[model samples]
Target: MSRNLRTALIFGGFISLIGAAFYPIYFRPLTRLEEYKKEQAINRAGIVQEDVQPPGLKVWSDPFGRK
Candidate 1:
């Protein structure tokens, strides 16, 4: 490829990297705990329900399933 084409490709790639990184660093809700919670709640309404343990699942504390 030509020098100008290579330079353009590198510049465009750099710009793309910067743009991709900006959203998570500056515009994403991951900057704070409250923001993350609010963002998660906005899209996932019923995913954070209560956790219940069944009677048969009581043996989950053991990794090897020993009695």
Candidate 2:
């Protein structure tokens, strides 16, 4: 192979390998954490009679209104 082609292939291969190694260790954990949070909220709602809202699901009628 030519020098430039070999260099490009090596660089591309290295980036692919790094992404493959990182996805499970980094991205998978974050995904599982989100799932766990949802499960916890479901359990909390089941245990309580009142409805439970997840962290980001709040609605406000007035944006600037005081609480």
Candidate 3:
């Protein structure tokens, strides 16, 4: 391929990689803020006991001491 075409392809590929990396870490979380908030609230409240427990564990508390 021509040098200009190859350079364009490389630039496009770099942009695509950056976009893919940002989508999950930044854009997707922004779009799903409400869902993430609700999920976090449930976990904080220990609504699903099994999720907070492992074998032989009877109670769970926030290690950070946050209410």
Against the true structure, whose TM-score is highest?
Answer: 3
Candidate 3: misplaced stretches above 4 Å? 42-67
List the candidates ranked by lDDT, beginning with the highest: 3, 2, 1
lDDT (tens digit, per residue) of candidate 3 on 7-32? 99999999999999999877875788
* CA error at residue 34 for candidate 2, angstroms: 4.4
Q: Candidate 1's residue-wise lDDT over 1-67, tens digit each?
A: 9999999999999999999999886666544657676665686665523354455554324222355
- Candidate 2 local lDDT, 1-67, one digit each (tens): 9999999999999999999999986787566876755665676664533344455765423322367
Candidate number with the higher TM-score (2 or 3): 3
Clashing pairs in 2: none
lDDT of each: 0.66, 0.69, 0.77
Instruction: Mark the regions of model 2 whose C-alpha exceeds 4 Å error after superposition.
Output: 34-67
Which is better, 1 or 3, measured by lDDT? 3
Clashes of each: 0, 0, 0
TM match of model 2 to true structure: 0.45
Our model 3 lands, by Cα RMSD against the true structure, at 5.9
